[model samples]
Target: MGVSLRDVADLAGVSVKTVSNVVNGYAHVAPATRAKVEEALSRLDYRPNLSARNLRRGRTGVIALALPELDAPYFAELSRFVIDAAAEQRWLVVIEQTDGSLERERQILDGVRDHRVDGLILSPIAIGADELAARTDETALVLLGERIHDGPADHVAIDNVRAARDVTEHLIGLGRTRVAALGAQDSAVSGTAPLRLAGYREALAAHGLPETVVRVERYRRADGAAAMAGLLTGGDRPDAVFCFNDLLALGALRAILSRGLRVPEDIALAGLDDIEDGRYSTPTLTTVAPDKAELARIAVDLLRRRIDGRSGHAPQEVRAGYRLMARESTLGR
Candidate 1:
């Protein structure tokens, strides 16, 4: 027969109830008892029956992490951090890619509530307050971005507006005018798109500069490159451009270079997210770097707390930190 909890308890020299308590994450168990029980479990290679345990405890011991696109470097890196953070709490993560589709996101919410996961960490870009408000799930759902801020869920985010404004201001401080904005596909909506654009405009208005933008259907390298190329070939062009994310900014860089335009001399560039690819680009990108690791940690922590019924009655809002990373992309030195 396969090893079981009883065998682990016997090997650990502890009562079955005591072993169970340790397994259930009961803090009252002494450190020595926990260590002994854990050692026995390791030796016996005992894997708890997750389904039975979940039925008894009403917890699946797993959380669903839903993002728009798994291929985006920013979301990919965020998933890595969330997985690490969740593991520290003895929770497994099941990632679901929504492909920025509202229908898929809604389906994931329903699926999570159907007992597939104990909680959900959602990074919804296409979903809005109306969509979120329509749900009646009691499952612990924590949003990972500012797009759905008004929904009835705990949220973790960076100050998108302030971060965007600071990066735009940084470009302005470098004496670059005729600045154009990129990555605002739906500026009328109450999401990251509008919030980041609001920041960009504030910086421009403060400097007494007019706003010009190259809207795109998506925030990807190909779209960003296309937007910049069109701007360059047109009668109107920007001396500096603020892309909403690193991917878009990197795309614009390629477009800038392909046309034989020297960076920061002919066109300065800035972007958000400060992704790893941005750090190593030919002329290192100047970006508004949000504390992505902290964002993941906080979102996971909040979701865990909600699942444990430890969070306050009201939903929580936590804004992670951000900073402007100025480098070769916008400077001569």
Candidate 2:
């Protein structure tokens, strides 16, 4: 038979109520008493019956993490951090990929009514403010990206405009006058591309430079390569390129090198999201590195607050920090 709370309480010379308090993370227990109870728990290898405890508390002891694309390095890395954060809270995480589909995202939102999980952390790509506002599932939700701003949920994201501006400014400071931006999108449901484009434009206007943009259907390496190829052949070659993400930047690097062009010599390049691939690329990559671990931690913490009824009536919009990592792609190795 498994060791019970009674066994721990008996070994600690305390009542079962005191043992239960410590197990449940109650603050009323004295420090010394808590330590003693913890020692007793360890000695007996007493594992709490999570199922029974959750049943009593009316919770599932689980949370859902919904992201647009699990295959994206940024999202994959962020998911790792979120899993670690949720583990600290003793909560299991179920990850769902929406593939950036509006209908698929809405279906996940509607699934909240099923109560399969206690809360949700979502990095939306398609759903908008109206869709979020119309949600009637009453599930504790925390937004992870710039998809739906100021909606009826806690939001955690980096300052996309500022991050983009900083990367663009890095190229300008390198004396690249003809800087072009890749990854502008026509979608009105997603805010990431637009916010980044705004930042790029802001930097250009501040520097008295012309604004050159390449619209992309998606943020992928192929899109970046194709756009770079077009820029090269279209007779308006930019001396520098700022891709919205590292994958695009890497793709552009390949296209430039395939044509025997030197990076940061003939044309400097920069991007956002410092994924691992950026660091190990041929000339490396100059990119903006958002505090992804911190973003995940904050998102998980906010969701836990909502799940525990500790959040206030008004939703919170928290901005994570980021830094521009100057590497060989722009500065030369």
Best by lDDT: 2
Q: Model 2, clash count? A: 0
Candidate 1 local lDDT, 1-333, one digit each (tens): 577788999999999888888877988998988999999989989888778778988888899999988889999988999999999998999989998887898899878878879999998867777867778878989999775665678999999989989988988898888999998885335568888898999999999999987788888999999989988988877999999888999999999999999898899999999889999999999998888889999999898889887588788889999888998999942
Model 2, span 1-333: residue lDDT tens:
688899999999999999999998998999999999999999999998877777777888899999978898989999999999999998899999998888888999999768689999988888888879888888999999784566878999999999999999989998889999998988847669989999999999998999899988777899899988988997878999999999899989999999999998999999899999999998999999999999999999899889887678798999999988999989842
Clash total of candidate 1: 0
In Å, residue 46's CA in model 1 sits off its true spot by: 3.2
lDDT of each: 0.88, 0.90
Error of 1 at 110 (Å): 1.4
Scored by TM-score, the top model is 1
lDDT of 2 at 10: 94
